[model samples]
Target: MRRDPKSTTVRRTPWPEGAERALGTPLQPSVVYTAADPDALDRIYDDGAPGFTYAREAHPNAEVLAAKIDRLEGAEGGIVLGSGMAAATAVMMGLLKAGDHVIGADQLYGRSLRMLAEDLPRLGIATTLADACDASAIEAAIRSETRLILIEIVSNPTLRVADLERIAALCRERDILLAVDNTFTTPRAIRPFEHGADLVIHSVTKLLAGHSDATLGYVAARDPELRERLRVTAITLGLTASPFDCWLAERGLFTFELRYDRAEENAAALAAHLAGLEGVQVLYPGRSDHPQHDRAAALLGTRFGNMVTFQIEGERDAANALVRAAGQIGFAPTLGDVSTTLSHPATSSHRALTPEARAALGITEGTFRVSVGVEPVETLCAEFEAAIRAAQA
Candidate 1:
């Protein structure tokens, strides 16, 4: 893959004036670093600067990746964590105290919803679920004790777009922090910070990593104090990402723009094609029929993301048959892979939600979500056409 010019330039650190210099930041897999003197070590330990302590506290590769993410997101600072959930956990633990309340979107990733609804309450942190797409509903859910408003830029599986700017305004007026999960739209499509968000989080296991090989998460903050709080919490909780995974994910970032462009184009085309099919109900932000189409266009510009969801005209069995008939597409639970894949939220990501809850989110048994890849549009459409036909038969 060709290196992005900006990445190539920023990835390399200047070498000491006279010694041999390397073109790029070499992977430093050392679990610990040694300081030149006790005074230097004391300074390092006290400052908690990058690469000055044990791997779990800080590491070179992770710092490099964090810097890259911070630059990309235009954040004051950032940190990398073991997984997306780890990042979320660190944020909650760092920012909220016992008795604090959090307002979250009802259409969140299943695991996130479960954590908010079940786990946080156990720790004395109250949570209220509301429709994040509705700014009025979100405002109504807020209370005097509310400390945070958590939402996704584009909701999981169902592709609902949140009015982030308006929500951010509300949070600001109420003196509450707004944390946005940018996993679906990513920094390439939309930078939540630009729209007044206080913190932006991403699951690097998805588009930032590009490939499906690494598990990593990142959080970028507009405030340095908040970033430090998150970093300290991650260190205390031992939630730092592995050095090797950070390196791999950084490599993935090199090709992210290219991959996202192709996948987005393919997704738009697929959505249009699926909408024309006789027994399909397509849901994509790019389509005029989507309820949030104008909002998405205004917020994301031309990049409408790579996910396309639809429901077949039948019961759960027919949807299952359709997935089985799509011989050319891989059936995977995750998204943001280079190869096109399909996932059933009812069985995979959102299975923990009750039937009524799922129905409220418009996630029916016939609903199927596709993560479009950088494949030839003609080939992908043809294969899908055949699969749909076979399923109908």
Candidate 2:
């Protein structure tokens, strides 16, 4: 067994100062590794002495970013994956087995809902969907077979905050592992483990990476045993993050605080502005009107996250028109980028689920998600106002 770089007894060389600056460097995507050099090969994988066995198994780029994330997340270890779904699936599959049950939030990432509703069942894993906002609902959903409880710190599409501390405590009492997706409230805003969550997951593709350039995910666990299991599952399933994508993710992390700082301010200001406007139904974690506003305030404080969603007063066509009208906004599924990106969940991110399923989660056709960027609040407000007016017209 190889020693982790961070292990105190490892006696490893110290990382250079400004090592953090390396994260944002553009990735050299075409770097090739060859096994022909015997000396290099020996150094790379001597008796599993520590370090890369293959690019798939490990990469300096990925490890570097993972290290930073682990620090930010306050976790024993973290594993990066190809996507958020990969991260979720790896954690669940690695930790839970056949006949084991999972209690997951009803308002999870659409792909996650599908994974639980459609895929996990086929594998003989049972799941019960509960409203994460209600700790009692989660408690009720947990069966004797339940081994994992999954919740999102801030749900996707709908910017709702979960009662993670209470729920995590409940899971701990019941001896079940708790996993919270911290995608919306990136580690910079709040570290979920501090609130008792056993494992924290991130769609690095979203806020952690803080750019539209990379597709990556991560799982940070409090316990070393669980973290190792996640890593093993990732290695076996080939759910590893690409070195280049990891590099890009790292780059995104460097400016994460700055980006989110701007985006958060923008989101709050925009949310307030939207709430005051007539006929727009806004959903923002920052607002006191949010369903779990008090809880969000208690946990995340001033940073309620960058995601802001609202519904146009009109129907689906009108909403689609509004999306099209926002010409500066990228009409894509990605989030947490420097450039404001918009997504229509029913058609993009949640397209995998059925209409009924989406409706169940309050994800309507008119629901528009905005990953607030560093754009001036006034500019973004203007774009939104113009789009809404166009949709109404």
Candidate 3:
């Protein structure tokens, strides 16, 4: 449509529909869009029609991103949220009421534990912590009021692997929802639904986005109705994902498998080198010496993922010295970056946990988690060898 120059200060132009299609996904930042007629507008708003009305409720970039993730994870429906915690909040808020109870893996990410232990209680929801790798322990913790069971496929920092299929079966028998955090083991490894998980969650800020540049989270489910419940909660709570972030994440998604393959290889090589180093204990799911190595092998097959955690022979001073000396790797608390990075649990991820609690979880001041990146394996090992020697000295 054309407007008179005297009557309008701006003109809008669109690509000719039949002429050509761009090879790239266009970045859509518009928060509000128009419809052809009142009925069409109503359909967009009320019927969940095939058009975006607002970025907060629905947007092109997020829709495409969500759909792609749903397919990758074998989900009937999916939604993108503001951050990893936002997706976690959506699951808790959307599924439970005041009297309900939730069971979480004792080794969940510190922020997730904080939400379950502290934040959810404020809403009159109660939570129980269980040894996620032990199916019987989780079953014993379940109560009549239990509404959900949350566990990470590969527990953070310590690399414990939960028996997802076993836990999912228990959730089914008890008529409870099973939500598995697949952040560490991305969908390239396993689809939770095939193991009977009701919901699959991800810190898309991690491997899915493949780059540290994008910060977003995702929730997907085999049940579309359950997904709607989550979507509604995200909308009401203003937890919807940012359109620009979604675009960046989608762009990142295109090369995710490629990036992950290289990163995974580097992680394995780095873990081997770390294992050979003196005065360090390496924790990786792929290592047979790990506590849950058998379970990890059965659950994840060969795609054991890219995170590596190690403990220094000494304490806080040793960890600090290594961080200071590890010039080749960035000292970033967060993970899933393209370049290798290191984080101290006592000071960063698990800092919220009491010193005693941290010690109990095996997260001492000497423990460091590495987010292995798609870099040359030799370069990473050499840097780590120097860092360890300097710290020991």
Candidate 4:
């Protein structure tokens, strides 16, 4: 007798005998999987066996991608999630309790600052904001209840490089945890784990998935025990990433180093040229005039980074004019793309910040942040110069 047509269509097929293996990891989009024995299913549910029962809890794509990120970061263990913010949320939810205290930089990614200042407090967790660039400021803000100190390696917009070595020592002395948001620097620039950070976090949506298609995030924990807690928390909260997005991110990683190197070199050249513009003031760590030049030189690898910020002279209107004229460089609200793009801090990334806070951080209406990308150096230089002239006109 022949099998029913419905069963024939739905049943999984077996591969041919001695078939060649796929050169790359095949995308597994199966949401729910089965096991032969009921006892085996229970073991998988308990994480006693490395098999997937549910996509949200555990999936092959996420596992493989997480492993690669683990190797890159030199982490004890790691997890992948839906978005960068989800990764940050998982860290706080998994590790922090109601009474635990966290010390974070005021200049962290805008959304993270909002979470520290507003969201976490709702959970009865208290967070203190400090100037992470100043190790003294971070020390002064530390309390006996402080459980973690979180800061970006290179701050957004302003690009202040934190003194990780000093802060890591302080965390060690006080037995406090150190978490570095390394989205900007990535592991390519500096892996925070080697500098004594207990947790290395990244917004994989940006550089790791350099083409700007994937919205993924990662958190690498140095302690095995902590890793399990985070993994469980992420799974329970339904923050796990989709198989397709994880697959895209994996593809992006293959050429990440090449894109990063070229983009960084382009940024250095652009910053140098923009520095000489009549009225613009460039904020690049590679430049001697930058406040954190020495620290960036000491701490960062090869070049400064792919970000270059400059204030357009005159007013916001001048900045607007420049954006209008720079037809080649797309005006985007995001960063870390294959082609160069410009983002406005006052209106986009740092919009949540109040006027006073923005001004204090040197983020003005005229501030133009260029997310320098893997474009030809000569084209970037000429186009940006023309945009400046148009803004002045």
Candidate 5:
């Protein structure tokens, strides 16, 4: 009493004539390798295969995705890591020794700030967090021990766009490496290397993954030496991403343009809408009135990112209520998901920092961060309007 085969779900496709078919199984893609003599294996042992003899060093999935990222970022090479912090850590560890110093933006992702300001110091590496937007501040911060100058394409929380070209020139004059966290402005909107960055990094968990399904990171460099150092360090540290995660991140890459287009649209609209509302302090880089709007527009052009940070009139209680009231929205710290997410930096992403550190970065209690999704702009606006009204009430 077997069920009819026609009743089962099946996808039928026509195969070309003489297409290799025995049991109708698809053939797996093959890789070509050469090991003609015993000397080949010995040479491999001696060379260590460029520091990638283990999957933890370089998985096939990660290589494929890294190649794609290299192309997208316009770099000579790329390496994918388990997380954003891992990527950053690899860069710092590979390029800087105990006596080295790093100059980073005053306003950076909380974890990044911690890594540079607190963690690196423990290892005898010092850091200076200066206003990255000001070329003079960055120039003044450079010291003989300063090996790297790190800046974000767009500042998180503050959403200020840095002048990469100017900074790049400065770093070049001083013979220092310029590493940029291009997480906020993905390559889709801005290519950091073109603007003079020595290395570019991404938290692929965000817009690059678009769906927020994978936690992956990537680092790329145009300079061959820097690329090799980063890759070797990654291999030694064993912080590479898994094949499945790389595959997920690769699939997400296909629709990067489409997802970002829609989300950017929503972000622009929502930014404008929130500006007109009462009892709210909206900070959107896309808006003309924003402090760094011109810089953002110049760097990102017409397509700004899908992140918005605003402060409510009340306190953390009011902010929490607004977040809770927006039950329709995903209330989580993670961003770049297909579904919108809301979070409070003070308590979530930046919570590891002390109160003084958080305040220094302006992660106030009343601040609410939003990652706009592909939901209809009207629906999103309505939800936010209702949430803000609830907060004010």
Candidate 6:
């Protein structure tokens, strides 16, 4: 008689066997794994069992990290990669073939836009850039060859919130795959899977890691077939994340809830203060003055995220000076650090776009992107105030 597939009586060996043990999953940094017998190794490889054969294909640490993230995002399975761009590349290469077309958000991370606009075309894949916030625009841009729709949950620098649910519905009607970049909002703020997103990508270097140290990314999908395809592509491209970094990211995941709560509080207080300051135009999803504030509230609920973008009244020099005067803050190109950091879009994140394009997107030289950290609200406000005063002087 055949056993019931759903039976919970399946026998399993105790983990770690004997001798080697750990309260947490121990870091396995070995570049290659081995089995007691050659035939056993061949069986493991042929069966595609859960044992690691090579670091590039899979490993214990990366598996642990991926599992935690998969649970958080409500995905059937997921894979971690060397960087966020690598994850995006794997998704595009795995799911899309030559002659396929992709529809992307007009406002995206600068590098992502570059890939869709320049790189994908070179590979015989066509792409159309549309305003994801406008469902009609996306619908109009779709073609018969369209295979995927790419969007960011909360757009970079500008903080525009996409209508994910509406877009997902549109994608379903067209039988197109919907891929969401959830780096900015994170699973803690909003799980795109809950909104019908087929695939969710996150730059683990950002909020998931909670510190600026780890360089990692992950792609999660509700379909096991999609997840497996992405994993194979990641392995083929040699985009696997370092096991050490994966271990560190897992540690960071433990404190994500606490860190995110504090950071959100800091962002709210700082955004409110900045809005009232002289010569400052603050753009935060939490603020009702923002263009997509209502949408953000509905999708993200109470957590509005830790990013706030504002423009100083003067020129680029004034913005630079203000950043310099903020003695405690670091001017870094990246976000989601433990301490409050500032980034200038014109010279950093959005530098790839032409001047005309940047202008069209409303990202001027005076614009500054703030990655709010877990700092005291009063301290952050005081430092920003002093910096503004110095910039005006």
Q: Pick the candidate with the highest lDDT.
A: 6
Error of 2 at 187 (Å): 1.0
Candidate 5 local Cα displacement, residue 188, angstroms = 0.9
TM-score of each: 0.93, 0.89, 0.96, 0.96, 0.88, 0.94
Preferred candidate (TM-score higher): 1 or 5:
1
lDDT of 3 by residue, 195-314 (tens): 999988999998899778888999986787898899899999999888889989989889989888898999999999999988889999999888989888998899988999998888
Q: Write out the backbone clash pairs for model 2.
A: 24-251
Kindly list the per-residue Cα lDDT of model 5 for residues 1-393, writing each as its tens digit.
999987766844334688566652233222223354667656765765532334665656787788888888887678999988889988999999999999999888889988987899999999999988898999999999889998997787767778777889999999999999998878888888888888899999998887877899999887889888998899888887867778888888888889988998999899889888987888888887888788877777887889988878877778877887799999887788877888888888788878887777777788888998899999999999999998888
Error of 4 at 45 (Å): 3.8
Candidate 1: C-alpha lDDT? 0.88
When 1 and 2 are scored with TM-score, the better candidate is: 1
- Which tens-of-lDDT digit does each residue in 1-393 have in candidate 6? 887876655754345567755788677788987677887788887986568788999988998999999888888678999989999999999999999999999999999999999999999999999998889999999999999999997898899989888899999999999999999999888888889899999899998897888999999877888988998899998998999899999999999989889999999999999999888899999999999889999998888999999887777778778888997898899998888998988899889999899988889988889999998899999998898888777
Q: Clashing residue pairs, candidate 3? A: none
* Candidate RMSDs in order: 7.6, 7.7, 2.1, 1.7, 6.9, 7.9
* Model 3 residue 99 CA deviation in Å: 0.5
Q: List residue ranges in candidate 6 displaced over 4 A.
A: 1-20
Predicted structure 3, TM vs. truth: 0.96
Candidate 4 per-residue C-alpha lDDT over 22-68 given as tens digits, one digit per residue, 9 for 90 to 100: 89989999999888899998887665877888899878988888888
- Residue pairs with backbone atoms closer than 3 Å in model 4 (clashes): none
lDDT of 2 at 208: 77
What is the Cα-based lDDT of residue 67 in candidate 3? 89
Indicate the worst ten consecutive residues by lDDT in candidate 4: 9-18
CA lDDT, every model vs. true structure: 0.88, 0.83, 0.89, 0.89, 0.84, 0.90
- lDDT agreement of model 6 with the native: 0.90
Which residue ranges in model 4 land beyond 4 Å of their true spot? Answer: 1-7, 15-17
